[model samples]
Structures are given as C-alpha cells and as structure tokens.
Target: MPKAIYAIWWDPNLGPFLGRSYPENDPLTSEEAVVIFMGHGLQQEAKVGYTKLAKGLVVSYLDSPNCIAVLLDENDDPSVVERNLLRLVGRINFNSSKWDAEITRAFLLLQELIAETSGQELLSNPHVTRLVEDMATGRVSALVPRHVLRATAKYPKASDYLGPDEEEVSRLLKDLERAGHLVPKTYGRRVECRQCGGTEVTLELACPSCGSNDIYKVYLVFCPKCGNRTQTVLVDDLTEVRCQQCKQPAKVSELSVIDVELLCKGCGQATNDPKIVLSCANCGKHMTNTDLLGGTGLAYYPA
Candidate 1:
C-alpha cells in the first residue's frame, strides 16, 4: 500500500505547489518537491511517469494540464500503485476552480483507499478504538443530528463525538454501519443536483415576484413627531432616520421601526416569502427545490 499520496500544482515560473496530501501531517516538503521536479525533469521532460527516490517509488499522473498527483510507497508494486492512483484520480475534478475543496476530496478518497488496504491498522487507531468502545459501553447511544439544517448530509455533530473532521467522522461512521456494528435510521432527505449528482448544493433566496436573487429586507422608520416615514440609518450606536419631507432626525426610541417585507431590487416588489432555489456548485446548475434529487438522511445507533 502507498504510504502517502500528493497532489501538486506545477507552475511554469514559480515551481511546484503542494496542493494536498493524504495523512495530512506527512506532507510533501519543499526539498522533496524540488527533487521530484528535478528528477522527473518535469520542466523539460515527460508529464507523467514513475520514479524511484530515497523516500519511496513514486507513481505520478498528470491530473490536469498543470497539476500532478503521485502515490508514494517503499515496497508496493509500482504497477498496482499506478492503477490505484488512476482509479482515485478519476473520481476527482482537477479542472474545478475550487482547488481547496477538490484537493480535500481527493485526499479523503486516498484516506478511504488506505483504510481499505490496511483495515486492521485503521481499526486499531486510538480514536477509532475509543469511539467503538464508547458505543459498546452505551456512552454514546446514537449519532444524532447536530443541527436541523444540513443534518445527515454534512454530519456537523459527528465531529464533537468522533473527531475534528466531520467528513472523516461521517466516513468512519458509515464504515461501521456498513460493517453491521451500527443500525441506521432514515429521518429526512437531502437535496442533490440532478445533473451532476453533487450534494454540495446551496439554497438561494430569490424574489417570487421577479425571480431575482437581489432581494433585501425592508426596514422602515416612522416618526410620529414629524409624521414622516423614511429609511433608517445607523449612526454610531444609535438608529437614526432623517425625514426627507421635514428634515428632522428621529431617534430609535422616538420612532417605530418595522421590517416591512423582503423587497426585490429588480422589480421593486415586496413579499414575506421568497422562492428557494437550489444551486449545484460542481456543475453550476440551478433549479427549484422540488427539482432536486432526494438523498437519505440518517442517524446511527450501536447495533
């Protein structure tokens, strides 16, 4: 099995930038990056190949036109490493502008591969052992939702009990559930993009009247002394509204401020409710909430 995997971005003028690494603490250092660049002759030679270094045998692939990914292992078969690297890279979108997110996903995929390759080692991890022990002892009865929104899909609460990385914890919990150590209960559904099937969907509030996302809450200030209604403004720590008709400033205490409605900037219409639109980050697809695909939201209990 590979000891570490790296995603590196090669720049023509600057050199290599270490994008991400699996087992994050063990990152590919500057010296190693220089060696890889010089040894492979990346500037002048082949874009992808395998090479043996003092650290290990590295199987590299050109993930994108400028990005390279490599798997490092001292004793693993180079052919096997190359094959695994190809399989793992195939699942990632290197062309995406969101480099951080894509690189993180790539590393997570690498972690899964490492876990599968060394299942016993992973199960023996101190954190994993403690989590299992806690569940077995009834200390943690079930892994429930941390928040009402983005519930099972993000597993925000799992980090509190399992580990700092919610995604990693979620993956571990799913592994245990798949292994029959935990029982799963479906309580809700998540919306996913129908085109790309990506779960990273964001909800946008659009004006129902004009179907525009440029909506702002309307706040009106009413001054009884001047019998004027105008927009409120923040002056230092106080709310002040200057009437256009009387040119009199009214303090917050002397005025009745109300949140009238959500006003659309496009059509100048106000409404209490706005249309919810689901947008896919991966494919840039926009659709109504009802048009999205439903995914299961789950809570887990020790079996």
Candidate 2:
C-alpha cells in the first residue's frame, strides 16, 4: 500500500493549496508541495508518472489543469501504483466546495475496488472483527489518538478509542488496513525524550544568562521629549502615558514603547531571545531542540 496520498490544487494567484491528505495530518508541508508540483513538471499539462525522491517514490497525476494528486509509495511497480492512483482520482469531484467529504468518499470506493481486484479475504481476527463491527454499527467513526505524543512512544495506549490496550488495538488496526478495511492518516508530529524514550515533554523558555524559567514580559513607556522611561501603569479610559519624571501626560504615539523585552526575575537580565528547553515529565531530562527525537502521529479511519 502507498505510504500516503495527497490532493493538491493550484490557484492562478495563490500558487498551490493542499486540499487534503488521506491521513488528514500527513507531514507533507506546503513548501514541499510546491517543490513536488514544480519538480514533477505538473504546471504545464496533464501527466502521470513517478519520480524517485530521497525519501521514496512520488507518483503524481495531473488530473486537471489546476489540480494534481500524488501517491508517496516505495513500491517497485510504478505502473500498478499509477493505475491505482488513477482509480482514486477518477472518483473525486474537484469542483465541489466540500472537497474533503468528496475525497473521503472516493477513498472508501478505492479501497473497495482494490479489495475486489486483489481478491483480499475478509479479516477474521476476533479483535479486529469486533472493531469492524463497531464501525459498521456506528459505534465509532474513527480511531483517534489518545495523546499528543501518541506516535513517539508506545507506553501511552489509545484507551479512549477502544477498551483494549494500545498495542493490541494498534496491531488490530494494522491488520484491518492490510485487509483493505482501514486507512491510516498522518495527523502531526511529536517530540520524544532521548534519555528515557518518553513523549511527555514540556517546552519552557529559560533565561539565556542564568538558565532560569522565571522570565516575563515588561512594558516600558519612554518619553521621547525628556528621554525619561517608566513602567506603564493601568488607568481606566486612559489612552496616554504620564511621565513621572517629566510630569507631563503625552499621547502614547509621542512615547516609544519597549514591550518586546523579556525580563528574567532571577538575574534581572532582559533579552528578546530566550533559550528553548524541552523537559521530559517522565525522567526530568532537559534537552534542546536538536537533541529531541521526533516521530509522526497517525490516526486510523475506515476505508
């Protein structure tokens, strides 16, 4: 199966708007979409082909003048992938305002077609069978991620979606996808702690000088006439700053406002840039952005 499928549309003035991705939250960014649109020569005319990227094979089809669909897969058979992609594209109504709902319906149809074409057997696993039954009976619309760091660590189970444990539910969902009954979508990415392999991480802005999290924003009102500076005070229905040294009330426009500086309470140091630290709630490990491990989050939906 393809790792992901993307639907992209171009505006004559807006460049490209990524309409949707199967796993609704695929990590493919807007800039990468533009690169794909240009790199695959999709702007000139309608075409269908595959190109190998550093990550995987990108099979793209410009189904219309302003719209294109792509499948990111590592399958060796580009022709087979192209054929399957065309089958999906043919069912989508690109002109519809409700493009999201239209594309989702198309995916369901595509799954049914693929299952029939491959003569795939129905899933017989009891756990997955019950999950499918629940879906069919309207008990569950989708299997949602229980936590923000769901993709980073396996310790947190998707207990909210189903009664079973996370690992068991995940394995069952994979079986459903392999059997052509479910589809996976990328939702977002989360950071993991390298020290303990935990996803419960919190971000904090520490003082660059003292490495303390006791930092706060300060609003200072500066009188340009007298070169006097004073902390701003709260007054009802006031639109001006009264300089304490100058003893004059002037319009705020006449005074320079320095509100961008972040003051550290620990060291009394003021700076605009603070060091970003990621602290793990599990192991109490602190790390920088480069030291954290990243993982992709996914959610499952019925095909």
Candidate 3:
C-alpha cells in the first residue's frame, strides 16, 4: 500500500550514493561501485518507476526496479503489474560502463538526479549525460524539466555508492520498490497507458473469434464426423468454414457477426461496417446500426 519503494545494492563503495546525495551530478565508477543485489516484492505495474542505474553501461539494469510507486487497489491484483513494470527496462545489445580516468564527477551527479525523477524525462534528454561514466547510474533527472538547470552531480568511484554488477543494483532497487521502502512521486499520464510505442498487448496473436490472447493463440478439438482435424486448408464455396476436428462444416451464411463493427487497422475507422439505413415511406425516419435492428417491419409491406 505504500506509494513508493526503493532498494540499493552498492558496489563495495558507491551504494550510499543512491539515497541522500553529496553534491551536483557526481557518481562512483564500475570498479568501486560494483556489488551484487538481492530482491524485494511488489504487486507490479499499478505503479510508477525509474532507475538511477540506466542503460549503456548499465544496459541490463532494467530487469527490476530501483524505485517504484504502486497503488493499493481494492482487489490487489499484482498479476500483470510485474511484467508491466519491466517494460521500462531496455533490451540491451552491448555494454557501456567500462571507462577510463578521464571520466568525471558528472556521472555521479546524474545517478543522484534520476533516483528522484520521472521515467519519461530521464530517457528523452541528451546533454544530461555528457561527462557521465556509466549509464548504469546517473542524472535521469536531467530530462525532468524541473531538474534540468540544477545539474545533478556525480561522485567518485572511491565512495561505497558504487556497484559491481549492474544487475545487482537492479535487484536491490526492485526489492525496495516491492517492499514499499522508497518514496516516489505521483504517477503521471504515461503510467496509465495500456500500450507504449510498439509494446502493445503482451500477447502477439489474439483469438479471432473471442479476442482472448492469453496462454496461446490457438486450440484443437475432436472432429465430430471424420475426426480428421488436420492442418489442411479446405476450399469450400468460398464462404463456409469447417472445423478440421469435428469435420463439421458450417456455412458462412449461418454465422452472424451481428451488432459489431470493424475498425480497419488500415483506415482506423468504423465506416466500412455494412450500414443499415432507413427512410420512412411516410415520415422519412432513416436509421442506422441499432435503429435498423429494432424495426418491427420492413418500411414497405404493401397491403
């Protein structure tokens, strides 16, 4: 029920950096900041979240949460909440954290910043990560409009604020978020959406008949007559569809797709759903959709 939760797994050094920070955008290094992480539990996506440890150097950090804001719904359904939460975690191709001495205190500051901001801004901005060493942790707040000018500073690798494996840091953060230990700001418009970018329903193919996309996209049953429900595509009158299982063929004419209109994925509208229009022989009362279905008789029943 806690609105926010946070956890941290410090490198033998920089772990402390995740909490109350020291200065502007400063952060520790991979060597000193490396640490393994454990986990905590939370329901899931009915919340808001972001990681101080981001991608690039920390490309793999997204497997879990560093901090999250969850709502305590009456039913307490956390079933999908976990998977929804992981969408923010990126799918990394390579790694980026290994840098040299040229790295500055800038990265340290970045980590401190994002630990306290929203997810959208952190992923959008450009300059917020200029001198930063690791994406695993830094100024996600730079993208946050309010935190832009302040320049969240970075710390040295010398501080226990560092983490060894970015994954450990990921686990620690998720653990805290799950346990309701961290305090996150109120969730914004982005959190409420059922889809973002190309990430639509978790299921790829949905059932054409009932629209049920859970478990699998298909099912098989016994054919009543032939019991020969094979994968063969049978060509009938170009209308009737037969169940390969029951071997029972049904006429396309018999099935009714009534009361439903199709939204063309191409046109993005409901115009093509065969419309039913009426013009009163006497009063000219033309109707469509529901109006057509409810008529007692065809307007022209000649006596």
- For model 2, the stretches where C-alpha displacement exceeds 4 angstroms are 39-43, 53-55, 119-303
Better of 1 and 2 by lDDT: 1
**What is the Cα-based lDDT of residue 277 in candidate 2?**
76
lDDT of candidate 3 over 1-303, digit per residue (tens): 112222223333343224211221343333322321311212222222322232111111222333221222233324223333343223211132522211222223223333422333332333222212232244222111111111111122211232443333333333333434322332211101112111111213333334332322121323444644333222344665676656577554544332333333333333322322233222233322333233221110001
TM-score of 2: 0.35
lDDT of 1 at 210: 76
lDDT by residue for model 1 (52-108), tens? 666676767663334455656556655444544555766887777886677667756
- TM-score of model number 1: 0.54
Order of models, best lDDT first:
1, 2, 3
The lDDT per prediction is 0.64, 0.61, 0.28
Judged by TM-score, which candidate is best?
1
Q: Which candidate comes out best when scored by lDDT?
A: 1
Report the candidate with higher TM-score, 1 versus 2.
1
